[model samples]
Target: MVRILQGLAHKYFSDEEAIILLLLLVVGTGFIIFFGAMLAPAIASVIIAFILQGLVAKLRSLGVPEIVAILGVFLVFMGILVGFIFGLLPLIWTQVSALASEAPRIIRELQSYLELLPDQYPHLVSAEAVNTVYQQVSAEVGQITQWLVSFSLSSIPDLVALLIYVVLVPILVFFFLKDRRVLISSIGRLLPPQRPMMARIWHEVNLQCANYVRGKAVEILIVGSVTYVAFKLLGMPYAALLAMLVGLSVVIPYIGAAVVTIPVAVIGLFAFGWGTHFIWVMVAYGIIQALDGNVLVPILFSEVNNLHPVAIIVAVLFFGGIWGMWGVFFAIPLATMLKAVFAAWPVKTLERSPASEEE
Candidate 1:
């Protein structure tokens, strides 16, 4: 046991730099676990700043002054933030309330239809089974109602926090972008200068993460914009809202598209009665999804490497479980970081064989 422990230590924990890297990782993990919710805005701002850093760099490369470039990027960021807050959010919120108010009527109509199922398919579905399913459905609806009531009542505190975030995040982002060099230097000073493994990991993560994040932002915008145009042309209700949902669904590989499809299809069926409009809407949506998965993603990630499908799913489930939307948003990068660390960690093989020894 002592020999095994020593061997493992020699392989993985031989250097002060390795110990420092591990300690930093542990501390960062602890910080997230302890203060994730409270510090969500700050963390979000940092990520936004990270994404916009590329834009800033590009502007600088065009011979724009650093301060001017930062200001320009920051203004664009603020414009989008304001547009979301004052325009899109309110529209989405209005539609959400409408959906909520109409939910009971929809449920009643669905129940009435379901109640006729046993009559239409007596051999397949017994009356007793229909009754049991009806009861379960009703109970689930009641649970959803209770949750909605609680959510609406509890949203006051959340609104206040959101307002605080609105005030704080821009300031943090401005400073982060403006003083990026100083911040990077300060962080670099804490690490050992000669740490090759840590430096390699940082470089790889920075390059890949930056590309991935910027590409994702572009994907979401393009997908959402195209979807909105399609839905609007089809005269669908809540076009902006559904388009946004469709856009964001790309974050989770397989599950998001599947989960969100139900609502889109239901809404279309309810509105257009499975007619040509409904068929057209669905077909267009399918095309959009296909293009995104096959075309946009491949082109965007062509420079960046692909993550394993299983790794992505596991990361989405694990981190999304922990941090909700934020976890899901950052899951790929987090998984990549782990992949890099594990790949670079020192390991040795003991491959001495009896046949080889004899030879």
Candidate 2:
């Protein structure tokens, strides 16, 4: 056993392990820097806007004229953006306003509930303490609203930057699509002769990313459609807006679905009143999750890059902490890339062979 342990350690440390470790370290460092660079909202927006360009490129390859595809996709995306702003925004605003109007009533109900709690446990009762808590909570809420307004005002520069991205993304995406073949050939030529393996790995990674992108699009559509119908049936105000939010939230791993449900259900309960309708909405969401997990996910999301659910969740949390919404948006793609890289490594491949794979 001692000799076997020594042999194993020596094999890992002295053989290709050292090189692989170094490559992984370098890749991690580069990713950290790349994320930091994407902190610029313009950069982030441009990157997202390129998704449309990607769709255009796909259409062009399918026999549509390049210019026509680009124009069509661009216009469709812009129209949707405009529709959301003009149509959905007002409904969302009105519903939100209604919720705000009900805040005092909810507060009073909550205080009554608290009073009941203290009355049940006389030892915990303190009239002054309860008043202080109520006052402090009210004051904190006012400050939060003020902060939100200030923050909104401060985002003017970011909005302007996003406009620049809207103009630039298409230009960049067009060039990227036009030169994609050239880029791949150039990259292939640059691969070191000793590493003929890298070309195959690159091809595999490309295939994996393509599958993931297509699957994700389907997932988003299914989620959005289901959410919209559910919200509408519930008689919830701003159903479209909530549906859009729920659909988009699915992009984030783990808690996204539940996170979206909170606001929708809370508003439904308060604005529309908590009763059969609210419960049915909850039931609908639960049914949706059951369908997603059993039916939808299996059918649409079957092309996973072999990443564990935990790894994807961790990536979402890590990136979301650093870059907030944008990080969460790109988490799956980045995680897929990491999985591809790991899969391409010789040690990982060998470790998953036959007996080792079973272990």
Candidate 3:
């Protein structure tokens, strides 16, 4: 057992640089695990700044001064932020309140439909099964209602935190963008000057993550706008809310789309019933998703390394479990970072067997 342990250690961590890199990763993960919530504003600021950096760079490349570029990007960001707060949010909120007020009616209608299932398919569905399913759904809806009540009652602290983020995030992001070089140099100074493996891993992770985040931002905007237009044209109720869900659903790959479909179907059924209008809504949604997956994704993410579906699902589950929504949004990039680290990680070569060497 001792020899096995020694061999394993030697094979994996023989390099001093590897040990240092591993320690850095461990410390970073531990910090996020313990203090991530407290530093969420800063983390969010960093991510926002990182995404905007590409635009800044593009402006600079077009012969704009650095300060001008920074100001331009920051102003556009602030404009969008303000517009969302003053315009889009109120619309979504109104829809949400309406939905809440209508929930009981929706549920009763759903129950009525469920109750007919046994009669409609007497041989396939029994009244007992329908009752059991309805009971479970009712319990789940009851829990959701309780949660909404509690959340509303406890939203004071959250609102305060949000205000702080609203004030602080823009400031942090501006400084992060303006002092990007200084910050990079300062962080660089803390690490060993000779860090080939670290450099390699950083290069890979940075390219992949940056591309992913920016592409996703664009994807969300395009998908959401397109969905809103389609829903509005179809006279769908809560068009903005459903459009937002459809947009954000791309973040979780397969799972998000499936989950968001429930709400879309429910809202459509409530508004248009089980008729051609409802069918049209579903058809439009299907076309949008198909275009996004086949056309938009290929163009936007041509540079990204594709993980296996199983690996992607596992990453989504693992990271989403740990960090909730943020984890779910960043699962792919996190997984990519892990992949890059493993690819560049230093390891000692083991001795080849004499029989294999002869062959």
Candidate 4:
């Protein structure tokens, strides 16, 4: 066991740089795990600044002054932020409240539909099974209601934190953008000058993560806006709310679309019943999803390395378990970072003895 352990350690961590990198990763992950909540605003600012850095670089490439480019990108970000806060947020909130008010009616309709299932499919579904299912759903809904009430009652502190983020994030993002080089240089100064392995991993991780984060942001906006327009055209209820769900559903890769389909289908059924209109609404949604998967994704993420569906799902589950929504959101990026690290990691190959080589 001792020899085996030593062999494994020598094989994987023989390089001093590898040991240093491992320690850095451990320390960084520990910091985030311990202080993530308190430093959320700063973390958010970093992500936003990272996303906006591409635009800043593009403008700089076109001979725009760095300060001007930063200001331009910053202003555009603020406009979008303000629009979302004032316009889109209220619309979504109103729809959410409206949906909540109509929930009992929807539930009743659902219960009535389920009650007929046993009769329609007597062999497949029993009355007892239907009753059990309804009970489970009702219990879940009740729990959700309780949770919402508690959350609302406790939301004052959250709102205060949100206000602080709104004020501080922009300021932090501006400085981050303005002092991007200075910050990088300062941090770089702390590390050993000879860090080829670290440099390679950072380069790959930075490129992949930046592309993913920015592309994902664009995808969500496009998918949500297109979904909203399509739902509105189909005269679907809760267009904004449904669109938001549809947009966010993309975050979970293969599972998000499948999960969100239930709500969209349910809402469409309630609004249009089992008819051509409902069919059309579903068809439109299917088309949007198809286009997003086949067209938009390829275009936006042309430079990204595509993970297998299973790997993506596993990453989502693992990271989301660790950091909740943030983990879910950055699962792909984090996974990519891990992939790059593994690819670049230094490993000393075991040397064969003369007897083994002769054999």
Superposed by TM-score, candidate 2 places the C-alpha of residue 113 at a distance from the truth, in angstroms, of: 4.4
For residues 1-359, could you state the per-residue lDDT of candidate 1 as single tens digits? 99899878877788677788889999999999899888988898999999999999999999999999999999999999999999999998788767777777767776776788888998898878877887887787777767766886878998899899999999999999989889999999888878887887778778778888888898999999999999999998889889999999887777788987988998888778758989999999999999999999999888777788999999998998988877998898788778767766656555568999999
* Candidate 4 Cα misplacement greater than 4 A, ranges: 145-152
Residue pairs with colliding backbones in model 3 are none
Q: Please report the TM-score between candidate 2 and the true structure.
A: 0.73
lDDT of 2 by residue, 290-340 (tens): 787678777765766556879888989887777787678878877787677
Q: In model 4, what lDDT does residue 15 have? A: 85
Best-to-worst TM-score order: 4, 3, 1, 2
lDDT score, candidate 1, position 82: 98
> What do the candidate models score in CA lDDT, each in turn?
0.86, 0.67, 0.91, 0.92
**What is the lDDT for 248 in model 3?**
95
List candidate 3 stretches off by more than 4 Å. Answer: 146-152, 351-359
Q: Which residue pairs of candidate 1 clash?
A: none
- In terms of TM-score, how similar is model 4 to the real structure? 0.96
**Candidate 1 overall lDDT versus native:** 0.86
TM-score of every candidate relative to the true structure: 0.90, 0.73, 0.94, 0.96
Regions of model 1 farther than 4 Å from truth: 116-153, 348-359
